[model samples]
Target: MAETVANHILARLREWGVEQVFAYPGDGINGLVAAFGESDNQPRFVQSRHEEMSAFEAVGYAKFSGQVGVCMATSGPGAIHLLNGLYDAKLDHVPVVAVVGQTARSAMGGSYQQEVDLQSLFKDVASEYLVEVNVPEQLPNALDRAIRTALVRRAPTALIIPADLQEEEYSPPEHVFKQVPSSPPAELRSTAVPPEAEIARAAEVLNAGTKVAILVGQGARGAAEEVRQVAEVTGAGVAKALLGKDVLADDLPYVTGSIGLLGTRPSYELMRDCDTLLIVGSSFPYTQFLPDFGQARAVQIDLDPGLIGMRYPTEVNLLGDTRGTLAALLPRLTRKDDRSWRETVEKNVTRWWETVEHQAMLDAKPVNPMRIVWELSQRIPENAIVTSDSGSAANWYARDLRIRGDIRGSLSGNLATMGPGVPYAIGAKFAHPDRPVVALVGDGAMQMNGMAELLTISRYYRLWSDPRCVICVFHNNDLNQVTWELRAMGGEPKFEESQALPEVSYADFAAGIGLDAVTVDHPDQLGPAWERALNADRPAVLDVRCDPEVPPIPPHATWEQMKATAQSVLKGDPNAWHLMVQGAKTKAQELRRGR
Candidate 1:
């Protein structure tokens, strides 16, 4: 029964149904690397170019696969490099288990080489569950606990095993082997649905108001049909938080695209004027987007009881699974025949699409970013998974890229971190190799993380059955989102010179890596470039030189925002006048529409 600690660990992962692991090797974990290489029936280890990207790939795996993603790295700086990607999973509430190698047990407290306080480093991000396997026997119990805790808590967990312990002989206990035999118990899965009485109370609260709006988030991904039913019965217009963007079809008549900063006009209107708010599985933190206090009666449904009223005041808190709660509540509600509210919102959606289309068709000196996103949207194959880096490019993707309900994608979510889109696309392609994967990245984000990670894509491109991945790099030569934020904060663009980036040919870089690549500096070449990349036999990058000066106007702007933008124009900002006019027109139109 004797076995190496690494073997026991691999066996546990196999038992947990983990088929793949993302990792990067270093000298500190030579023992684990060798053991994994020699073991049979072990998880397929996909080595990434960087430890940071390996962890990001893990985050992406969890996002697309809906399973506990497994990733490993050697100790010291290797473990530290995992913090950002682990934090991405933490903020998004995804399950991920990080197995980190540590210095030898004999070297403890001796200031050994590459030694770091991993527990302290991971305390805040992986606080839900973290432990070190101090001895060989503890491996069985620790692995079981860490894996199950990560699943149950829906958060990242870390298991640090000293290299010596990893190489030591061990025998797993009989009972310990049965501890994590399969998926989490059915009780844990079904316990999240609220009691029938709670569902009834929520239904009553929802039925009391004439104008109701439903805002959903990532928690409602599985309850799309149920959400539609609830919205139909209550005459509610549906609005999605960014994470929930793929949940409901964007083309649905009653569905409003995203809410808050990068939201649609209909969504802003829906939240601004609704008499009742029925939030399902969403904790949209922007108070400005929600109806003011006392303006709407609220009912919130969430699996986490602690977050029920954290965003808005709730009259009835339905603590349950979104699908279960909505199913139980639907029968108790009366259907509304009047379609005025929904029709009005739909009108706004129609006008908004027109505005979006017009903007996408806009001609400029440097190519408009929206034009590229629009063309990509039109050409993106069904069920393709797409990701957008955080920046102005995200603004375009959030507003323009029409999401087909079957398509799966994600951003940095609550972390709102940059440099994850390309890594996310890499992970998604690995998880579902048959599906096409694309990343839309701003110039700054492309250089920040996408540049180095492109090498990882090149390394693994030929290994997969179908390597259909494309990175659409926005070569706008500026941190466009930050520049706009600076203007909105009443600062002149002249003083924010640090936001500008030196131009680089991402297409050339990709081509040099043996990828099929093209650069588009004119609108006429955009469609052909996208077509070329989409049909490439290998990974590709469409380096698009986009206009950095075009303003990404928010769906709704405050008076102070308007004033700040006006001030920036007076301060001699190049694009401020254009932005000011755009904002003024939107504000004036909303006022006329009775928003």
Candidate 2:
């Protein structure tokens, strides 16, 4: 006998090493949900408040653990709601396997309630997709391929299982799916690296320049130490894209800052003024911010040949994985002549620290958002997984928190999605419960998709797991800021205009569901409250109060601008919104600075 479509789906997930699959019970997915309730080896199913939250939690798992995160949702609204989370995982290079239930096979194409072109809807965004229609044979192949592609491409994949297929009866024994690796390119192993002369020439130019900077992108993940070696040899500072934050640890003395919109001034100015830029791993998107031929020369190293000249004009193109390229470059490169370059960058950093960072500590009244992230950075174990959502909280943590070991969080570079923090933390903590997890979420994002997962963690606490593995988020009450800011770019911005729940409390809400909760209104109150919540032996939440008027980040920012990130200066035809945005990026109080 064969397994049912739902059973086959469960088996396929197990083969991918998924211990749990996040989902919400629904009509379209009821069969699979029932299968989960019955099976012994079934991935521990986490019933989420909403489907989008499920997807996001899975994204968290995949990104932090480097394993595929599995999520499931029913057809119609549930499946549609997952698009944002799916796109986030895709952009962030998390290997996610999402199973979306559709109407019965007969009703899938037409004449079904809530039927939509899900495959077409998600095709461009998902790395791979399959409309699973059978139990034993088709599901085994389809889901296996989906999982494998997600891992290989380092992006999200999907399996759309129709209701008929899921409910169909079949054999008893399950065949666990196994994906055989396809043949590597013929030249994969034999391809020798380029000559040492190329590296030497690039090194010579790098060493010769008094001011040089390294640019790392998403491509820098595993080559941190190597990049540091290159930085040490070059005596140049480092700047990274948002996605590349973890490529090098935040405290590396050579780091200047991150670059792009909401990027710091030093990186923009340094890259703009510096004589040479070393492009590693990343093919960063914001080419307008990149220095052209007038001020800087670029030497780009990437494994993808197509990416060589796609962004910035390249002075030297080294084609290979960053690790291989850096390893080869290190041996041939000479120690840089400009030993004072790091000192200059460090000086600027120190000035930034005193003027921006220190003043944040002085905020005594409504606890400054900066102080919260900074304090969290100091309080949490360095290696603890720190995830942040969009808007103010995200901007604060990204710029303020110095992320430490085996750490992974959300950074949807250009998209800047909301509701990422809690779900990502859920996934991160679930995958690595031994690792402490903390998420700093805004009231806005918390309301969107994050609040739904409160019970998910609560259930885990019931098992005596490390309750500290998940941080509680009761974000500031301005719960629709991300949607409002995003409206200017795309849709209507009316969420702030009319909030449905004026008196709703996420902490209370979590507690109502048999979880523990805490609340804090002032910024100063946040640190202690969170510390207590984190130290609690079970799942818990802390509601941190923030002023509704405080902006998430400034569009026009300097170094302090990075954490309270700023956008590019607006057009001179400035509007009130732009003026307000500019003001938000400015420091409220500056400490007296001494060089």
Candidate 3:
């Protein structure tokens, strides 16, 4: 039998060592679907419930696996559905290759069913590389380039295969005019190091300052040891950007948890008080959260030269691999004999954790959302991988969850999109089948898509060596994050029509699908509920009835923000009294445990 372009594409993927391709089926992709069966699913077809979930699962797999994630969808609506998740990958800088089907070539301009201008559709999202395979000969080179470009740029790339072209007889790029050939599959590796002169100057800036603060991001994942060594030598406090929450263990004395709005007090203070800043592999936006310009000398090291020094006014920009740049900078840095600043930072971190614990234990309508994460933190496996969805749940995951040991964690960091929480956990499970994966999601997100993905878990859990995938849903009957945002940022009362969420029993849904399930309406039930979910022989859902009014106040909440909240309360917010009481109690913890 002659190999079709679809068969050849799968062969190429296998050659590139792609174990699974997250996808959904449609007639436009019938050729590839048929190829999957003919090839005996060599590169497994991991069917997701939706095209968007497929893209997100790929992003999750790529993020956790440190490899390029691939997702597939059919033309038009299926292709359009992939945009959000692809944008999530692009913004968060995850390497993902989106292989999407297109309408038949003859029918493309005729506006046939499911026919859409895919090239223009994918242009912005897959800006690094976007190609439409017009012939069977274009398959290998185009697909290969998509994967390579995605890995090299750490962004989403795309290949649009027309329906007719996919079923055509496979033909290699001929050794003739206009033919482009690609080399065999292999990851290109390089360790870029900044020039010695720049490294020396960066060191001089560090040595001259009495206080140093280090910020790490996902780019620093490979440089954890170097970051730790540099921090030790410079007597610096390390603050993690949310995306880099798992870059360094939270147990580290000077590792001030996440920075920016969802940041710890110690992290905010670290930036406010530091005389010098070393940003390692983090392009953390929110320059206001960084040290005041001209108040501190700064050095930034990043793999992408384009991102270097863009976030802050860095005196030295080292465009190199974070691990290598830090390695070069470490030796030049003199040990700070004045460890007073380091001591202060560590003390602040300690007090912040204490305050976090107190806040998590504070009274609420039912379960404190913070306590849900706090309980998980206490019992989460040393080798677990955790993901969080954006919302009030993220606030608790950021503050209350303590990342330690081999535990990995991430969320929709740059995009801050909802619905990736459960999908990311599923991807993490596929990436590391031996490890337990947990997702902290809000009720809004669960209702949006997380619940449907539970069936995906149910289908795949038996294949995993460790069947401990937990989706912990914060079951507050409101879009709590935006509700608070309206009060704190917009000075508007919670407009119940838009903010309220229709309540649904997530645990019941999970149980119906033949997975472990538990619900926690009280703080006392949280720890036990987490235990059951984490130890379940299959995937489990923890539907926690968290307090909707428990505010996710920033550690360094501005006076204007507080004023706005007050104004909203005065204007008659639905849960004004509960919001005030919860906010007061939560803030009191920080005050009582002051550094």
Please, what is the whole-model Cα lDDT of each candidate in the order they appear? 0.83, 0.68, 0.92
Models sorted by TM-score, best on top? 3, 1, 2
- Model 1: CA > 4 A from native: 174-188, 494-497, 572-595
lDDT of 3 by residue, 110-174 (tens): 96998888989999999999999998878688989999888989999999989888899998999
Worst 10 residues of 3 by lDDT: 186-195
Kindly report the root-mean-square deviation of model 1 from the true structure over all alpha carbons.
2.8
TM-score to native of every candidate shown: 0.94, 0.83, 0.99
User: Residue 518: error of model 1 in Å?
Assistant: 1.4
Poorly placed runs, candidate 2 (over 4 Å): 108-110, 127-136, 167-208, 303-308, 362-365, 405-407, 469-476, 479-504, 514-516, 548-595
Residue by residue across 485-505, what tens digits does model 2's lDDT show? 543333233343553235567
Greater-lDDT candidate between 2 and 3: 3
State model 3's lDDT: 0.92
Supply candidate 3's per-residue lDDT for 210. 92
- RMSD to the hidden true structure, all candidates: 2.8, 5.7, 0.8
Better of 1 and 2 by lDDT: 1
Candidate 1 lDDT by residue in tens digits, 1-595: 4678888788778878887789998877777787788775378888887888888899888888777888899999999999999999988888899999999889988999999988899888889889987777666668777777777777999999899888789765445553333333222364467788888888887888888999999889889999999988898899989888888887788888899888888899898889999998888888889999999999998987766889998888888788988888889998888878878878878877767777777665568788898898888887789888898888888888888758876788789888888888988887888888999999898888799999889988886677879999988788888888878776565355688787678988998989988989899999988888888899999988887767777887777776776677788876665555554554454455443
